[model samples]
Target: MSTIPLLASQLVVTTIFNSIESLGFSNIAGKVFSGEQAEARQEANLKVNTKKFYARGLKSLEQQDLYGAIKNFTATINLNPQFAPAYNDRGLARYKLGYKQSAIEDLTTAIELNPYRAKYYSNRGFMLTRLKDYTAAIADYNSALLLKPNLAQAYFNRGSIRLQMENSLAALADFEAAIRLDRDLAKAYFNRGVTRYKLREVQGAFEDFQKAAGLFKQQGRMDYYQDALAKLRQLCY
Candidate 1:
């Protein structure tokens, strides 16, 4: 997988974990009547096991064990079919495994299960963008931003698509918004530099490249650092 998609997958995983509190079985908590005690216990067990497998899936993903992550996430979904996060995470695993079409299908299911979650749309948008469906990808990003206006990654992703479409001015605006929301986003600075260069803003492009180079080096992204330095060299001449 390319760097952008890998970064987007990391963002998706982080977003899911951060929002985990909102993703659990909220209906599991009510008082159970005498006749329903057995059923309630089974349900509770299912929830516990589902969470256990889900956690394992996340651990596998963190360790870069893609197949293990997929297996665990599948177990999570089987235990709790309503668990949208499992499908979302499984999709990411599938994407990394090069099952792009299947990955999109899983992400679609996640969206169907929980349309209110902004990250699902954003995740799907990344997949669609990879498939070159720029229009649909843009629509997904638009939906994500509408649901969560402060989504810096969404802005950065949309800017990347815009840059690819050759809409340098609009791309510059999106990269600027992303940078405003997250100053540490090295890729946003790099893309904004590219956008500025396209627009003939030489000085602004040079500064963004320099910033991106420093950020990439600090973040231990030596390949990106080299690319940023190449941009600086191009600008100097």
Candidate 2:
């Protein structure tokens, strides 16, 4: 429910839509088959309907209509229960609606349906962190990293959790990894600055805060930019 996790959820939804669009489902009937033409046709129709409902769900999410998104995502799943993306997206909608346990369950089902997708694990990890299940959250983040080593968000989330646990050194490592993967990730720099400050690395912290402020300004995140500047001022003066 906090700003960072909410942003993560939004990013995940955007990634899900991008993945769906990139797949380019063209009529579903375009794939020719030799046998069971009638069955194939039915399946194709179902796929098309599933995609339509999924699109509606995504639109609802973009509109910040959590209930509508959940409804349409449920329709998408009803049409195709094996659709991993639908479950993942519905989990996010559920989280936005404060259905924490239900969101975790949906995300778990998504992972079960498609274990290779790193974002599902990352999404579940964020929810678990909200639930204060730090151990499970760390495991999920670890799994996400295993599936996609360059996932900056997973590293950032894990770093945040580690920082909460007062493991500043480990958190710093994760934040550094996140920044390595995504130099423009202002949050990562800000958090790493925090971790470095905690560890008495004052100069490093100052540099990171300065970089974070610059990136946040470039990204139009005025609130974060101001926050980073405040931290820099605190460090300097």
Q: Which candidate leads the pack in TM-score?
A: 1
Candidate 2 per-residue lDDT, tens place, 76-187, comes to 9999999999999999999998999999999999999999999999999999999999999999999999999999989999999999999999999999999999989999
lDDT of each: 0.94, 0.94
lDDT, candidate 1, 1-237, per-residue tens:
655445888889978776764776344444345449888889899989999999999999999999999999999998889999999999999999999999999999999999999999999999999999999999999999999999999999999999999988889999999999999999999999999988999999999999999999999999999999999999888
Record all residue pairs in model 1 with backbone atoms less than 3 Å apart, i.e. clashing. none
Q: Candidate 2 at 195: error in angstroms?
A: 1.2
Q: How many clashes in each candidate?
A: 0, 0
What candidate 2 gets wrong by more than 4 Å, as runs, is 1-35
Please give the TM-score that candidate 2 achieves against the real structure. 0.81
**Model 1 off-target regions past 4 Å?**
1-33
